[model samples]
Target: MLLIVVLCAFVVFLLVVGVASFLRSRRDDSDERIRSRLGALAASDADVETVEYLVRRQMSEVPWFNTMLQQMRWAANLSRLVSMAKAPGTPGLYLLLSLTLGLLTGYAVFLLSKMLIAAAVLAGIVGYIPIWWLKRRCTKRMDRFQEQLPEALDLLARALKAGHTFGGGMRMVADEFDEPIGSEFGKTIDEINYGMDSDRALDNLLNRVDCPDLKFFVVSVNIQRETGGNLAEIVGNIARLVRERFKLHGKIKVLSAEGRISALILTLLPFAVAGVLFLLNREYMSLLWTTELGRSMAIGAACSMTLGIVIIRRMIKIKV
Candidate 1:
């Protein structure tokens, strides 16, 4: 009982600390922005103070904890995932959430099953919930961005035809369209305005948005800049192509709808049946968890089901 109490206390402490750090980071970011503007306006002769100020501004409020996590190999990847998901929390906060979830889940399972192995497995799976949620958010956001890309391109082409510069056209798109697309383009414009190379800024945009249509637009712009061509015409053509591709993609999804539905039913049937059986006759279903042979068969069935699910998913996934 004491151990459990201590563990719960530790988890709560971690959560409180994580929340505090997250709020502090938000405040610090605003302060950093102000300091950056001041630093920019300061005399160049105060180079040493400027450097020190910049370094201090970049450091996290909880230096030891943040530094330890940042030094971990997965930290960079987690940060990228958080950025892609457009999550408000920092990577360290996300990690803390994951850890808390895992430990609480493991403890609950252990209490119920009195089995370390079962607890560990459940804990591990639960630990990935945050990452799974992040990936899903990123996927949906990217899908929306892709859906908006062709229209954004057309808007840009019109802006260019109206005698706006490329940067002006980008700013127009940034101002006119809604999120993900607008925000991404706005970021690229900010980079360009801040003296980043146009190609580099666009490349960064490409890296952030993971849309093939956007890639085509970026490649076209780069090619136009290097080899010389009518920018508006090129972008217009790319926009048209993207629209056609999207149409074809819709047709493909329609054609694959049956296969996808079948896969979903097939994947869920086993679990659904087992659940029903457990509710109807707990003793009969208990064999699967209570006996060695039954446990082996259950594991084998799970493995086969997982493999089948993967194969079915691949079969239904049509790439455009």
Candidate 2:
């Protein structure tokens, strides 16, 4: 029944896509439609302290939804996440999809199981699917950016050493590397070319990218602009430092692999055992939910599992 509900939702999504494509096909060129939304990507919020930044984009295409989302703090965040990930669809669209899925899945679960707890839990997880996928994509993009940063900075430093101007070096990096470093630097270059200050452009780049090492590079550039210094040498040192940090982080991750594996096993073990017992003898396993004392024990076990997960996560996560 839940599968049917999900399939129905997916079918509706396909139908919507088909209608949009059919309408788009009537136009001589759909490029305009694509560019229309592309131009609305990667906007800055006006809340930052350093610059009185403009809200450069809207959260939704629908006027009412856009206006409603404008009042939400998290809506902007979702916009930022989508921008960073270079993912399709608006925050409002994602939220609407999540809500729809949650309602459908929750109703289906409640109808089948007749348990409010099961319904709510399934609903929450189903609702979070879009967000989870977006975050995963964002994290992957950030990691790629982080790994590319050192080499990009080195290339820029070498360009400077070869007597290329700062802007020229930036253009070189933008043209040479792949996304997200390439696109991010390209955006900065575009901003600079369009009469925006270099400082502000770099700040915008840093805002779009959640990389710590990029901060060092941006701050160094800003400081160099203020005080006269060998900018190329400073960038070179930053690249070396970033590489060293990467090495150390890699070592730490390797060392903590055991703990992470153990945590994963520990987390899934209870669910696995419960599932097996339920399959082997449904009546015996049903005691966990059927009696008051059993329910209390189950709740206690859940709390303990949550606590263990938190502790294990903290232990394995060593920040450089």
Candidate 3:
């Protein structure tokens, strides 16, 4: 019975993965969808064109995985890959490392499996898990940083109101505010002062953040350059809008928290139970882990778990 359950789960997981991949690919057919959303807001044509170009370029680069990754939050992952390749790590080296990890992990899992099919599957899954986890971590960290952006803007507005130049106010925010946001903006300010054009520095900041609100801000600054309005007041209004948007987003997340938690628990419970069983009754669990029947069962279990997770994630994901 235990073997049967595991086999069922694994098969289901495979099917779910297939479906999810298919759906993501289908959705990507309309790259225009994402662009249309951004077009609604007051953004410069140049900025919008740049965003559109990047999106298309990235989509072309990862043709298979880019669409699915939209929900998986992998922008930070992609950015890190770019930054690493440019600096300490070489692109060739990173690819080689991923390949090495994949091969070693794949071989180990293949050796452990009682059946070739299960071994192959497990090896592939294990190999990518580390990279997937790294991507998730980077995404969450970026989100947290973006969350503090409104606060940073508010500080800048206050400083400007107090008769400081825009650059001086930005420096004060960098000095007085906490890290992540402070560090990012401070770097931008530094770049600007070091002879980089303000517009280009601002563009770099927008690329780092890829958020609609920030895009609106950049556009506002450019437009005000020719029109010449109360710049401080405009920033204050942007700050207020960002705060309200964040508040609304928080409310939506709170409402969905229960479902999200339930999904997580459900997805994890089976693996946790399996671990306990292995520790307490090695002999009993060994047949499933070591025999041909056990390998099939493992495959099924993986498939089922994958399906369940995808379904739950879809259910709880509410776009504001």
Candidate 4:
């Protein structure tokens, strides 16, 4: 009874924290929008003091905990990952969410099975859910960016041929392409407008986007600026090369589809069989949980399965 009460109280605490975090984030977003508008108005009015004060106040008041977290190497890496994924939320918020989920899932599993090892294993897996979600989002976004890049390059080449400056060509691409590519180009143009060096601005764009094809465009532009070359022709050649690489990538994926599907089926087969056996005969399947030898065997099998899955993944992954 005490355990049940404690569990319920813990769950309620987590719910309250989650709700408070959500509300706080929403309030902060609205406040930021208001402040931006006010700041713009103050700037136009030439109220330097007001603008300075607003800037000072706009800085988040980081608590000691968050400051310490930000100082850690893992936190820095996670922050970079979040930025790459274009995920909305601070590193602290993501960490809190992961911890809450892991704890809740572990407690629930413990309540159901009364097994510490199983609960811990499940908890660890649940803790990685946020990271997995972020990686998935980042991958899809990069894929979309890669798909849009060849056409954007072609547009830029055309703009250059029409006698626009490089910056003007970038602006044209920003205005012409759809989101992600358009937004990225728009940001680069904004940086250039704000007096940033063109090379530095392009480097910043590369830092934000993890597309290898974009490197060819950047390198070609940099080289052309150093030497004398037809910029339009160079950019056109890059666009054609990117298109060919994309085609090769598609062919590779198609060829590996069977291997990927087989790996997935093999990975899930053991779990499916165990679940079916449990449903059919609880006592017979319960040995895997209730006995020492069964537990050891289960651990060994899990480790072997994980190693096999990794090997299979490496075998099928083809880099273009």
Index of the highest-lDDT prediction:
1
Off by over 4 Å in 1: 1-13, 21-61
TM-score per candidate: 0.85, 0.83, 0.65, 0.85
Residue range 1-320, candidate 1, lDDT tens digits: 99989989988887787788678667545654555444333323346576555633222347787778756777877777777777766777777777888888998988976667668877988988988898899999998998898999999999999999999999999999999999888878876776667898898788777788888899889999999989999999999999999999999999999999999899889989999999999999988877888777877887798899899999989888
Pick by lDDT: 3 or 4, better one? 4
Candidate 2's error at 66, in angstroms? 2.1
Q: Count of backbone clashes for each model?
A: 0, 0, 17, 0
lDDT score, candidate 3: 0.64
- Comparing 1 with 3 on lDDT, the higher-scoring candidate is 1
Model 3, runs deviating above 4 Å = 1-97, 210-212, 276-297
For model 4, the superposed segments whose C-alpha errors exceed 4 Å read 1-15, 27-65
Per-residue lDDT, model 1, residue 86, is 77
lDDT of 1 at 112: 78
Model 1, C-alpha of 126: deviation from truth (Å): 1.6
Candidate 4 lDDT over residue span 1-320, tens digit each: 99878877876776665555555554456654555444334434356687656633311123554567756777777776777787766566667677778889898889877778878889989988988898898889899999999999999999999999999999998998887899788877776765566787798789889899999999989888899699999999999999999999999999999999999999999999999999999999888878888888888898899899999999999998
Q: List the residue pairs that clash in candidate 4.
A: none
Model 3 compared with the native: what TM-score?
0.65
For model 2, how does the per-residue alpha-carbon lDDT over 184-299 read when each residue is reduced to its tens digit? 88877876765567888888888899999899999999999999899999999999999999999999999999999999999999999999999999999888777778767887
Listing every candidate in turn, what is its Cα RMSD in Å to the true structure after a full C-alpha superposition?
4.0, 5.7, 12.4, 4.6
Candidate 1's TM-score reads 0.85
The TM-score obtained by model 4 is 0.85
CA lDDT scores, all candidates in order: 0.81, 0.80, 0.64, 0.80
